[model samples]
Target chain A: MFSELLGIAIIFGATVLLAIPLGLYLATVYRGDKSWSDFLAPLERLLFRAGGIDARRGMSWQQHLMALLTINLVWFLFAMLILCTQGVLPLNPDANPSMSPDLAFNTAISFLVNCNLQHYSGESGLSYLSQVVVIMFLQFVSAATGMAACVVVFNALKEGTNEKLGNFYDYFVKSLTRVLLPIALLVALVLVFQGTPMTFAGKQPLITLQGDTTAVSRGPVAAMVAIKELGTNGGGFFGANSAHPLENPTYLTNMVENFALVLIPIAMVFALGFYLKRRRLSYMVFGVMTAGFLLLLAPTVYYEMQGNPAIAQMGTDMQLGAMEGKEIRLGAAASAYWGITNTIISCGSVNSMHDSHMPISGMSEMLGMMTNAFYGGVGVGFLNFFVFVIIAVFISGLMVGRTPELLGKKIEAREMKIAIIVALLHPLMILGGTAMAAHLYVSNPTEYAGWLANPGYHGFSEMLYEYTSAAANNGSGFEGLGDNTPFWNISTGVVLLLSRFLPVIGPVAIAGLLARKKYTPESAGTLRVDTATFGLMVFFVIWIIAALAFFPALALGPLAEHFSLY
Target chain B: MKNNFASAFRLTLALLVLCCGVYPALVWGAALLAPGQGQGVQVSHKGRLVGFENVGQKFDWPEYFNSRPSAVGYAADGSGGSNKGPSNPEYLAEVNTHVAAFRQQNPSVKPGQVPVEMVTASGSGLDPHLSPAGAYAQVERVARLRGLPAERVRALVDARVQQPIFVLLGPSKVNVLQLNLALDSLSGR
Candidate 1:
């Protein structure tokens, strides 16, 4: 037990320690200041020159959105074309069939938006050509897209008002060359050394020690797995995801992959501090996020370590804790830690099955996605948190009988509308989509009997979890959901598109509007957002809006299951 | 709009080559230095191909320490868990069935002495290792079937027990396949 607790502490502590230096480096890269990574500059220049992009030009927030959306549309179309015809494409040693149109639509949008909510499994559903050219390609650019959008907000948050944020293309290109690619290379090589496959060979048939014939699936896994964690794109090369032996290999690789999962999201918080030169504000934000993270993490670890009460009733020794749907190498503690970390950051890769977790632990995983802002997905996590900060600032300002201003810009009614919509949109999409699915399921249980793996309360969790994972752009699921049908493919596809973009647009718009307003420097009367009191306000605002909104639904699912179990 | 589209189109093409083409090729080249050259580490027996070192295979005979229950029956081409919710009556019944079968196989072990991992399905359906308790629970059955002394078999299981990195990082487990192979040599099977 001591070792298990120490294991989680060491992984998280290592991540934060690594993130500080990475955060400073990210600030340097985004600011275009000269640093050691300048060696990659010539490569960036070549990319810009070949594409005919003007890397020096500045962009308004509107222009940034346009560039981001247009390029993303290009990717969506490219992904669709390959996915629908992958059977005929080259590099398909496994000869996996092409996706049906609806699956393709879900997959294309899922990867393009960085959600990676795969309706289809790897190894058999996609050819190698699509895996690299479409899936991995989208993972790289989608993450860079989020980072670029975040840099736009960072540029806007400076003390003086300005229309021209940094050029979107410049930030976007540098995000790939400077930040993501180098780290991906280093991590990929480490994974390869630890026995994660990077070959393009077909599955190798083998005889087991028991003399049964079986074939092990082999692929170029290390390259994709590295970026899948680094980019917070949790799509897996194999159906079992990181839980698969070849995909994860051992405990050492488990620690490495878990480190890659949250490294950038935490680093971005510190990057905000470095970029704005507001270290105290960064500390306050980090404190709140860490507090929420520990709250979710602690209960999950406790319940998972306490073992399943149902199994205990059967007179079995559960000293290993809830070992069902968990790797023995990772054990219970690290698996629970990975589950919460992945959900909190929208990484969504699993080292253990969340569906098999204790009811309270399942609730914690759902809460992580429902809140969607504790060290969020790559660059977008900060954007979601920024929305809450705005709402908190407005409420605090009203209470103090003064107009709300954040970083010297007044927050008017216009900004509040956007923030509230973005906040409300999360629950609206999740609950709304879940309600629609439940209505269909309850209305015709026999017809859609295959849609759920467990009946009653646990069944309802399957549907709710799918939509919650979709709406938060978190891709992990209760794998028992049986969610490959057209209904799931199309519905979650729509949710993924809306949930990913609108929140991004909402925050960028608010920041842009505030950037244009006249500057009001900090005064003694100014609400101190950097203080501990204000941090508590933001924390409450998040729980009230993000957590409380889903309380009734959670009651119907994991909470009800918990009551029945004990 | 036209200029933006053209720039976006060209940039997408360029990035595809750099990311999908160059990045993977570089990793594939460097992986040549790794064991098995990034083609998955394989284990062999008597100079014949057996299995990948880290993937679990089914071992149900009484002479071997049985692997954990698997949802996909240890299919390596694809993998997943049983994904059974803890409170589901049907899932609980299934666990009860596994518990009964385990007791039938090993009559010497008491009802509550069975390790939970022996009956529960693993996440990947390809979990390579078993908790030390899980392996030790089956020591009596395997030793009786192979006609070896229980002490020798217990020592073999002990030798195969892998501690967590530095004994303080993760779970201590014994790889099931390796342990069984060691059993085969011990009994000169």
Candidate 2:
């Protein structure tokens, strides 16, 4: 128990310690300031020239949005094409078949939106070529896309009067080359050293001691695992995700991967501090996010360590904790911590199956996705949390009978409208899609019989978790549910696209609109968001909104499961 | 708009080359310097490849250390958990049956002493290792079955205990496959 607690403490300590310097470095990289990676400037410039891109040309928020959407559309089409035609593509030593049109649509949109909610397993479902050219390609670009969007908002915040934000292409390219690439390279090497396979070799035919011949699929896993965690994109190289031995391998890799998952998201918050030159405000944001994260982590870890009371009643010992749906090598504490980090950062990689967790642990996982703003995904984590900040500032401003202004810019109706749409869109899509699934299940039980793997309350969680994962742009699943069906494919795909883009589009648009407003200097009357009081207020606002939005849906699912367990 | 689209497409092509082709190739090159050169380290017995050191295998014999229960029968092709929630009655029944089987195998040991990992299926049904306590609980059973002294078997379990990486990640565990192989040597089999 002491070691488990110590491990959790080390992981958190390492994340914060590494992220501070990384945040400052990323801020410098985005601003095109003189930095250690200046040597790569020549190559960046050449690529810009080759693509007919002028690095000096800034874009309005509309232009930035168009460029982001256009590039995304192109990538979407590319992914869909590759996925639908993977059967004929080279590197398919296993001769895996192409995906159906619906599955392809889900997969393409899923990856493009940075969700990576795979309806298909990488080892058997996707060919090796598709794994590299389609899946891994999307991992980098999708992550880069989010980082680019956030940097645009950072530019808006930094120079409040600027008519144009920085170039999206520049940010995208630099994010890949300067930030993600270096980190991925180092981490991938470490993973390979620790035993994660980097081979393109086909499945190895092995004879088990039981005399049955088993084929173990191997791939360029180390590379995928590296970016998957570094970018907070939790798509795995195998069906079992990081739980697969070849994907995670050892406890060292597990800790390293967990740290990598949260590093960029936390750093982005600190990057906000460095860019805005408001270190105190960034710390305040970090404090609230950390508080929410710890609150979720505490119960899940304690409950998981306590094991299941129901299992104990059946004469099984509770010693060694809840090993159901968890890697014993990771133990309960790391698994619970992984659950929190994965959900909080929108990194959906699982060392343990969230489906088998104690009911309240499941609720914490859902809450992490529902809130979707505690040190969010790569660049977009802060952007999503920034929405809550806007609401808190507005609500508190109205309560105190003062105009709601952020960093001197007034939070007008337009900004509020966009923020509300972005914030509420998460629950709307999650609950709406879940409701649709339930209706389908009820109306046509036979056709949708295999849709849910488990029946009753846990079955409802599978469906709810799927939509919540998609709507949050989080790709983790309960996994017990048979979710690769056409209905799930199309519905969750739509939710993935909507949930991913609107949060980004809404936040960036608000930032753009605010940047254009005349800067009002700070005064005694201004509500300082940098203070601890305002941070606590923001925390309450996040909790209140999340609880109200998700409590009923949760009540029917995990909450009911919690009571039933007793 | 056309120019922007063209630029975006070109950049995508470039990035695909960098991320997919060059990046993976670079890592693949670096992996050649690592042990096993990206292929997993295989555990061999008398010049015959037994299994990958990291991967879990089936060990159902009473004389050998048993691996954690598997959902997919320890099939590496499809690794996963039972995905059963704690409240699910059917899952509880399955666990009860496992407990009954465990009790039947080792009647001398108390029911409460059986570790959770020993009965519950791992997330990766192919878990190759067991917690030190899990292995120690079964030490007397293996000792009696193999006609070895209980002290010797306990010493073997202690010897097989592997520390968590840097003692800051995961828990102390014993590789079931490795320990069983050592047991085979100890028994002169």
Each candidate structure's TM-score, on Cα atoms with residue i matched to residue i, is: 0.99, 0.98
* Model 2 chain A: worst 10 consecutive residues (lDDT sum): A207-216
Among all windows of 10 consecutive residues in model 1 chain A, the one with the lowest summed lDDT is A309-318
Write candidate 1's Cα lDDT for B1-189 as tens digits: 678888999999999889998999999999999998999988898998888888999998888999999999998998888988988899999998888898889887787888899889999999998999889889999999999999999999899999889899998999998999999999896
- Fnat score for model 1: 0.82
* TM (B chain), model 1: 0.97
lDDT of 2 by residue, A184-227 (tens): 99999889999888887887777754345777778889999999
Cα RMSD over interface residues, candidate 2: 1.4
Q: What is the lDDT of residue A442 in candidate 1?
A: 89
Off by over 4 Å in 1: none
> Considering every candidate listed, which one attains the maximal TM-score?
1
| CA displacement after TM-score superposition, residue A473 of candidate 2 (Å) | 0.7
Predicted candidate 1 versus true structure: per-residue lDDT over A1-566, tens digit per residue? 77777888999999999999999999999989999999999999999987799999988899989988999989999999999999998999988999999999999999998987888879789998998999899889999999999989999998774998889999999999998999999999999999999998999999899989998998999999999999998998898899999999988899999999899999999999999999988999999999999999999999999999888778688888998899898999999999999999988999899899999999999999999999999999999999999999999999999889898899999999999999999999999999999999989999999999988899999899999999999999998998999999999999999999999899999988988999987898888889999999999999999999999999999999999988
